[model samples]
Target: PSRSATLAALDVRKRRDFTVHDLDHRHHLWHEGDDARRWAREAAKRATVVLGNIEEVEMATGTRNPVAGAAALLDLGAKIAIVKRGGEGVYARTASEEVTVRPVEIPVLNGLGAGDAFGGALCHGLLAGWPLRRTLEAANAAGAIVASRLACADAMPTLAEIETVLARKVSA
Candidate 1:
């Protein structure tokens, strides 16, 4: 579905508290020029949180820098913006603060579902009331774990698996 249509269909008043938009790279093929930016800005405005890769954000905002793109989303009324930079890290920005979670190093076998894994882990952290940094850490680890496995959905890490990855990071 078109981003605008998706936005139009959303009942922000009833679902804003839990709504999150993952402006994933796949959407790039569906939009162009100002339309993409407009849709992105509108999506941000309607959702409680917005998640996108750096490239997606840049494309959506017509900006070269992801941070600038995130700022634009915030200016458009997004409560939170998360820009995922593969290998480098994930950067999360709120009205009050910004946090960067470094990527976990792992051999990548498949990346198709890494973002989905990260988003799921992020939701888990948020629902559990974990701090932003910790949430990002777990999300990043989840992505790394998925990327390192040959299968996508089958590779999604369990809580114990995520903890193991975090523990390895700390010990290193």
Candidate 2:
């Protein structure tokens, strides 16, 4: 299903059942003013998980600190919140704890679609029942691999590739 369709359904139902929202800031460029802020906050409050970069988090939650911003979202009702910090890696928060995953460097050919790759791996980890740290590791690795490549969709790594990246990190 399209993201807009899913978002519309969520808006109507406020269903909390394993919904993941990737708050791509570019998509919300049209949002401004108090009403827009209210809408963004409400949309975040309904999700089981919300993922975005620091800028997106600040734009939605009006805070510069991702962890603090995520905590605010949790107060509004999201179960999990993640802030993607490019080279700094990711910061994830839950009601009980917060964790930051440091980035793993790799050759960078292009940055396009790295975030998409990260989101995909994040969902994969959640669905597979991996711990938050493991999920972030996998997502980070997936994103690094994508960034090292020149293409986006065509360069998506296979499961084996992801596993290899994880293994390398472990050994290092």
Candidate 3:
């Protein structure tokens, strides 16, 4: 779906269900896609958060430099911009802070939707009003858990399970 149209929909639906107000974009840039920037800007006006696939950003923008892109989003007023870096971790930024959360080391089985899982967990944490550090930690643990197991959505750990990993210092 087009970003601008998506943003318009979110604006209407936000009051009813904030959980469904996720901002997703295909990881590509249109160079001509000024609409995306405008959408991001508009969502920022409503204090919306942005989550995205890193590969799409790299392929479309011709760069994987999430920091730069995040800066653009921040400038446009996004409350937070999360860029999933797969095995490395997640890069997140807000108007006041920037954070690079490293993934916990774990044996990998299959890598699919790990980034989305991490982003989803982070969104959950935000919804719960967790602090940024705790949110990143929870998100990282969730991604690591998903990476270590073979199943798709089934690999994602429960909050209790993630907390267990967070408490340990396991070497991957």
Candidate 4:
């Protein structure tokens, strides 16, 4: 599915189902193919939140630097932009603020579905009206927890589990 189309569709239902709308563009695997890159510009303009990995951010903003790509996304009209940096960490920006949450140190296992965990946690944080910095920290923990486990969906960590990891880190 195209993030552009998905965000557009969700925009219509914004009054009913969701308050915060987010777009997560892909590099090229989406239905729009190469055109998806062009579509991302419009998608970022339409969405209040834009979240994607480095490649997706680069594809959407037509920029090489991930940080600059995130800034471009916000300039295109997104109220916030989140760039997932995998092992490096995650960077997020809004009109008023920006934050970079470090990756949680953990044993590696399977890497599949980590993005799902990260995105899910991001949505959860947004829906709950948490600050972007706090949200990214939790989201980072969620992805790390999933990556440190054996599988993806089956290993998706609960908020409690994520907090536990964070708690341990805070204490250590």
Candidate number of the best TM-score: 1
Per-prediction TM-score, please? 0.89, 0.88, 0.72, 0.85
Alpha-carbon lDDT, every model: 0.82, 0.82, 0.67, 0.77
Clashes found in each candidate (C-alpha, N, C closer than 3 A)? 0, 0, 4, 0
Name the regions of candidate 4 deviating beyond 4 angstroms: 1-7, 13-33
- Which is better, 3 or 4, measured by TM-score? 4
lDDT of 2 by residue, 56-162 (tens): 88878889897788887787788888999888889999888788888877889999989989989998999999999998889999999999999999888877898
Each prediction's Cα RMSD? Answer: 2.1, 2.6, 4.3, 2.8
Backbone clash tally (model 4): 0
- Kindly indicate the candidate among 2 and 4 with the higher TM-score: 2
Model 2 regions lying over 4 Å from their true place: 1-6, 12-14, 31-35
Task: Report the poorest 10 consecutive residues by lDDT, candidate 2.
Answer: 27-36
Query: lDDT tens digits, residues 33-89, model 3?
Result: 455545544654454466555754443333568987666555544667667676677
Deviation (Å) of 39 in candidate 2:
2.5
- Candidate ordering by TM-score (highest first): 1, 2, 4, 3
lDDT for model 1 comes to 0.82
